[model samples]
Target chain A: MPIRNTDHAWGSINKAFHWILALLIIGMGFLGWYMTWLPNAPGKIKIYALHKSIGLTILALVLLRILWRQFDRRPSELPMPHWQAVAARGVHIALYGVMLLMPLSGWLFNSAGNFPLQWFGLFHVPSLTDGENPALKAIAGITHLILFWVLLVAFVLHAGGALKHHFIDRDSTLRRMLPWGTRAEKSSPPPAMTATHSTPNSSSPTEVKS
Target chain B: MKTVLLFVLASGFCASAGARDWSTDAAASKLGFSGTYQNEKFEGQFKKFDAVISFDAADLSKAKFDVTVDVASVNTANEERDGSLKDKEFFDFAKFPKAHFVTSAFRKAADGSIEADGTLTVRDKSKPVTLKVKFSEAGDKATLDADTKLNRLDFDVGSGDWKDTSIIGADVLVHAHLSLTAKAG
Candidate 1:
């Protein structure tokens, strides 16, 4: 596949960035929950450090992905009802917002709680806030938890939407975003396209954007 | 002229005769320590401590120093770490909240610094420790600066998982800077 997105399909670069970030976010969610109840020990401390390091990494990657999205062409919305289109756009925006906010709140909590962050024991990230304030720490902690729940719900909805598009809608909405998959057969395009396209579908392996 | 000379001699003799009691000015004094945790250095302090000192520079045999530190007052700025430090495996603040240090002998070192041979008691465990002290007096104000190093394991500071020095270091550096007011006896 090409590195740039076409109106019909997402490019390889965007697919890679999306899937890798998805995996990391899921892993971070598990780590965050597990580390909270861990007994006070050296192992627990190390795991906390690991969690912080990964959260920071996700933050940086998401920022770069946002910048990349701004410059790169995005696949136009697949055929759906006008309301569904608007809902999809809203979900995309919410996902991006949660991705950015979650890491930031975690960083703020660590700073207010006076927990020093070292990136994989390589370099220290200086705290954004000064001395420890219990009040700010508690607030940040609560904010972080709430954001995680938001992210979790949004994630489920996103995955469900993708599966619905594949199994029920029978559209290229899911397959186009896959890292590797069989090309959509040209002989039998879904019936939904016939209403919009005047020309008979070509026999080429690649689907032409309407 | 004769009376003035006799009074001067008597005053000079009196100055060297007795040890004066010195009370630490708590507002101006600090008792702090630092240790390595996971290869990163962290600083902490005891917010409440009292030092009782009596000394005369002219007489080393008469000098005495005693200090009491509230272990529960440990502030590392990180509440979680501070909470763990006060538990049974560490200072055990609930059972033994105060750490005491008392000097048995005072001697002048070759480098002109004073050395106090002392014993430090923490969590009911007492260990012999020596503090290299530097003393200076100006008018009615006196300053005492001392530092010493002690192995945390020696006093059973961390019991089970903490005994691994690779994670939290074994040696803890303790230092004190005391500003004292001397009361003439």
Candidate 2:
């Protein structure tokens, strides 16, 4: 219900951004795959335009989410082994990296292919490159495909980690991030200083302890 | 005043007589078009095309223009798009490999530019198109630059599902620049 993250759970805003972006990425994966095999028709072109628009949207949203994370508090790390904690950090970093690279490569491919990109046909995004270069286009295309696969693998691992915490580790790692999960009653209220005023510069001792 | 009027008429007739037959220098001429696809503009040219031009600047009625373009020679610099354009939904280059245009009349417009009225045939469909042309003469050589616009759908260029103009625009602008040398009589 809170707009900012707590030491115990994710806030409403962060959860919304996560779930919406997750759904968009999954839908885009299907659209990107299916549109390639579609016969040369108006419908195919329409589908391609939709795919590009959604891809651009994801790119913009990811950038905003990164900026938002800077100011908001992250939930305290769940109790785990040292190696697990390190692995979790690695996966998170990889996910963010792929999220940024995937759309960038796609944009470069479109620009080099001399294809015009429009976001829902409202306006045009200027091409990043001048003129057409088939070689650059091909390379960017291959890079995009490779990044998408990386994202897919990262996503699977991420989901597996969350589920592992929920069922095996018996922690709130999954539940605390869920939009509709019931908040468990706290035996002692969190310190007032750590409640709602956490800034990017404020790293509490609790985070250090975790 | 009467002598001056007679001199002016005589000079006009001499100029008409000097307007000779011209042949296109194929290597120096080009026929191309540009169209929008997915809101992006792309240029394409017919690698093989011929234009027959005969004109007398003093007499518009005696002018004639004819052109033939090999449809399969369309090169858009993109293989995938070129391939699709030649398919049944678009140019249908397999069944119709050539497009032709022949002018019926040439007139001098109010702005002093030449205009040719012709029927352009593509994919078995013919539609009347008028080209705004500018002609200039230099010694024994002449240059002709012309442009026109046509709706691809009118010529059945992209039929069936390809008729959706939202993806591929309906309007195609064609351009031609020709350098011609007067034939020795």
Candidate 3:
């Protein structure tokens, strides 16, 4: 597989970003949920700080992913029903939107409260607001809190769609995006697709290792 | 300004004799404080504070100041921090609505600056404090600018998590800038 994306599969760079963000988002969800429940203590503050730092990291990585996407072509959409394809596209868009927006809302909430922002405690990030703005602070904080639910729903839908393609329809939707190598044809195709096709595109018989 | 002119004239006429009383222009004065929050520096001001001033350049023994600051008026530019600051673990504004400062004596420093010895009362604790003062008397208006450093822990201002000074420093720099008008004798 190539380092850059191909017409049929994702690049290593894209896959790395996808999985890394996925893991971080999952971790952040737990941290965010747990920290709010903790009693007001020094330990809670530390955890909150860590959450901010990791959230900022995710924000930076999301930007890089979007920027890379500008230069990198996406693999063609797998063949599916028109409604499923549309739903999949909507889910993907919403996921990307949440990924980009979550950090910004957090930053606004921080800035609106005129709170300190440090990138992993290395340096400060400039505040967006001038001073203590009660209205903006409340609004931004609510937005930040609410977006977590949006992220969770979008993630479930996205993952569910991929699984559906893998199990029910049995296509290359999931395999093309998988981290490991598989010919996407030999082992990944539905039994019906394999039985009908004799001429496969490119490559000799590479062993399927999924 | 008319009062200021009269007070200035009075002070000038009696400069050789005694200390003159002055009143602060609340609109033109500020009581500010600053400290670090993590790696970032945060600044705040006490919006409601009143100071009574009596001073003479030559009469150090007679110079005195009494100030009352509303603890609940503390604004750190951060609303969450400001809210947190008023809680029981911090200023406990519900219990102690006011902080007080009173200067008992004044002395000229070796560097020809002035220092006022005083006691600052915050929450339930009182501590001896000294304010480094730069008292500049303009022709018609006198300005009283003073600065002092305070340890919040000294007064039990920050109790629970705030004791971790590494995250939020215990040392707070308090500054006062009062636009003063002399009161006629």
Candidate 4:
């Protein structure tokens, strides 16, 4: 009567954090890309501020996730091949590593730059390094750009894997993460007795034959 | 002895008359100077320049100066950006190749400094600017340091959204150090 290891899925809190953080990271990447080309647009400041705030939020959440994982036990592993399990673990680890690196790199980049970094205009964030050093600034700039590309590729790979399991594997790969459809009993459709036989005219007589 | 005295007086009159002319430099006087300028949140120095000043300090009352600045020779040390600055949007060196400051009024200040109020035309836009010149007498040389504030927008140097201080700052400070050699009038 107990669930097997193959049936194990992520808990509610883990599922929520994973999906929300994924969405935020993807959104931040797109905003960063678009910002480079919009030359002095009116909405540039608003969008840029939102980008900074979201990036900082992601950094905080990633740190918390690290701490949480340290104390909490994750779901039992799926009864897959050894190679598949190893590959899954490796990709998962890489994802978390990049998630932490991307934002921190961006923070350092803005700090080294001569331009001041603002967090939604409410407060001023001081530079991490002096902007006068052109060499340091260039190094930070180049690495920041490279990390962005890596983060983008990694995100696509993560999303693609999830979609593959949902459509091709036809498993509860995505269902386990769906907030409202997790309950076993509630997961199934209701009985189809009278509702299946009812015609369109039952609710509105306009559909009845004259 | 009376004839000798008349000759000395007449020679003194001729020398003073020659000094009154704008061409007089009062014994090969050299003007040496230095200053600072602000661009956006960045402030830099004008490293190298020579102003061939030919105005008499005493005859500054009736003196006029046509000062020329080498447009291609401005060095802010930011070569990439400064290179673009020499282009049409800013300096337009191809059309108006040189920037000029022509003077009409030169007043001696109470603090022994000289203030020259002139029209500096850059990129074809002329604005009245007063450069307060501070000088130190070193033998026959005049060490001159002048400072003045410049509005980039007034000369159409930078305008529109580029004027936003958050992006590229507006107020540009033009500081000058000039070395001039004076010639006899």
Best by lDDT: 1
TM-scores for candidates 1 onward, in order: 0.88, 0.86, 0.87, 0.64
The lDDT values for all models are: 0.82, 0.80, 0.81, 0.58
Give lDDT for model 3.
0.81
Pick the winner on lDDT between candidates 1 and 2: 1
**Model 1: per-residue Cα lDDT over B1-185, one tens digit each:** 99999999988777666477898889899999999876777889999998889887878787889899999999989998899998898999889999999999999999888899999999889999999988898889999999999999999999898888867899899999999999865
Per-residue CA lDDT of model 2 for A158-186, tens digit only, reads 88888887788666667667777446314
Model 3 chain B is weakest, by summed lDDT over 10 consecutive residues, at: B11-20
Q: Across residues B1-185, which tens digit of lDDT does each residue of candidate 3 receive?
A: 99999999987777655587899999999999998878567898999998989887768887989999998998877656777888899888889999999998899999999999999999889999999998888755799999999998999877866789877888899999999999875
Instruction: Place model 2 in a CAPRI quality band.
Output: acceptable
Write model 4 residue lDDT over A111-170, tens digit each, in one string: 654444656666666667754456766787787788787766766666666576558754
Error of 2 at A18 (Å): 1.1
Question: What fraction of the true interface contacts does model 3 reproduce?
Answer: 0.83
Tens-place lDDT per residue, model 2, B1-185, is: 99999999988876666446789888898898999988778898898988888887877877888899999989887767888888888889889999999999988889888899999999889989999988898978999998999999998888887888888899999999999998876
B3-51 per-residue lDDT for model 4 (tens digits) = 9999999987755554322222323332222122122244444333334
- Candidate 3 lDDT, A114-153, residue by residue in tens: 7788887888778888866779888988988889999999
> In model 1, which runs have C-alpha deviations exceeding 4 angstroms?
A181-210, B1-18
> Which residue ranges in model 2 land beyond 4 Å of their true spot?
A181-210, B1-19, B25-28
